[model samples]
Target: MGRKNISDQRRGEIIISFYEVSRSLGLENASIAKLAQHMGISKGLVLHYFKNREELLLGLNEYILEQHLRVMVSEDIGKMDCKEHVIHFIENLFTRAWNTYFDDGVFYSCYALVYRVPEFKESFKAYLIQLHEVLYKKLEEAVAFDVIVATDLKELTEVIFALIDGAYYYLGMYNEHDLAYKQQIAIYVKYSLRLLDFRS
Candidate 1:
């Protein structure tokens, strides 16, 4: 690869390391020196890429949001009828993606921090709004196709996302092994469908 490409790749690696370290250890405890040591690189190299801790953290937050959106939009949830789409959506959010992306507990930690840290709150809210829009569109298409019963698509989408987030937060807090998480999520999915009066 070109030098620029190599440098970019290294920077990406450093950012990821920073995120992981910060997630495991609180932001206050995760320092540049520790991150560099964890990555087996010098602190100067980390600074060479990020300039400072704030810049590195900003990049990490942006990277996490982008990764989350990528996962949310990856599947063709709009292709299925409303019921099928809802089922698939729940499966993706509560089963597959949740198990993969959030199993480490870092995402929830960052989410909690966003509430306290003024720096991350705006960006986090923006990401949430974008995700809500995508989900609302999918639900609207489902309602139009008669896959689900008539309901407010935007409201329902927000409720579903909130429920998913709540479930994941609890799972991360109490059930890290994910043993009973699937069953709990299934219950919530069924309850949500009933609220929408979905026949299927």
Candidate 2:
């Protein structure tokens, strides 16, 4: 039993190492040898947990998707008003999701690969669509409860998502201050609500 547990732990570590490498170097460049060197492990050891590069890339995508789901489906969304919730969500996203996964060059590499690489496009798009759906549902709930006065939930949700995405991208590329990111997102959210004539 102890041996089995150790093996499981090692396997988990290998997966995490692969994810880190992929996030930093892009899936195509995060080769097994490079990952092994980074993790201080042998190529055979990585192969023990994953059959090949494809398997490792797939596992990385799954791990990233799971993390995204956890952030998007946070319970905090259900507990706060639309304005507070949206602001809180955006703030948390920058502090948690952005800071955690994307504090280095690796994330940019992964982003470039995910969008430009035809093979990974489907997984990337699926993850984005899932995120959008979750946000849409949360925004729709806010509308139903009269927290936001938007008649078109879909459009409002897209606007919010786009605003947040744009803010994060800009912050990631040039600025690196949490305060500025939050301020920009807050302003966008307020402007969006006001444009929709949402009175709250």
Candidate 3:
């Protein structure tokens, strides 16, 4: 690999190790030393990639953003049409599938730092905007394809995201298999589709 690719790969490795350790141990207790120990690497090597805890936290936010963005585009979206894109999004939005991406505990932990860290706040803001754009673009395509009619695509996107954000935060507090959890997800999905006037 090239020098830059190797550097990027090394950063990724260190960040993933950081994430794993943070999940196993709370983010407050997830230190550079613990991450190095978990990865069986030297503390110096970890510092070589991230100079300090703040820098490491910034990198972790980048990693978190990458994983969260993956939820916007399914592997099958390329094969599906515009309408399928919208359906695929709605179907996956309220699911516990995000667990496969990143642990909610670790995610919220990083989020807490946003109040104190400017870089973390910017990175998080980017995540939110990117997420909105991804779905907004898809909804625009659906409108062009004559799949769904909407008066305001932007408003629709925000409304849907509001439901998702609210439902996600509420649902995270309960067991995924709980009846209230499942029922609330169903109710949100139903209303979200209804807002889009989506018959499917």
In terms of lDDT, the best-performing candidate is: 3
Instruction: Provide TM-scores for the models.
Output: 0.77, 0.73, 0.92
Query: Can you write out model 2's per-residue Cα lDDT over 1-200, one digit (the tens) per residue?
Result: 99999987887788788877766776557799999999998999889888887666666666676677787777765543666775565556544354554333544455566666676667677878888898777667666766766677677668867876776666665454557766765676566555444455
* Number of the top-ranking candidate, with TM-score as the measure: 3
**Residue lDDT tens for model 3, 1-200:** 69999999999999999999999998999999999999998999999988999999989988987887787777755522456666667879889888889999999999898899898899888888888998888787777666788569899889999999899999988898899888998898888888875534
lDDT-better candidate, 1 vs 2:
1
- Candidate order by decreasing lDDT: 3, 1, 2
Off by over 4 Å in 3: 77-85
Quality of model 3 by C-alpha lDDT = 0.85
lDDT value, residue 105 of candidate 2? 52
Least lDDT summed over 10 consecutive residues: which range in candidate 1?
95-104
Model 1 lDDT vs. the true structure? Answer: 0.73
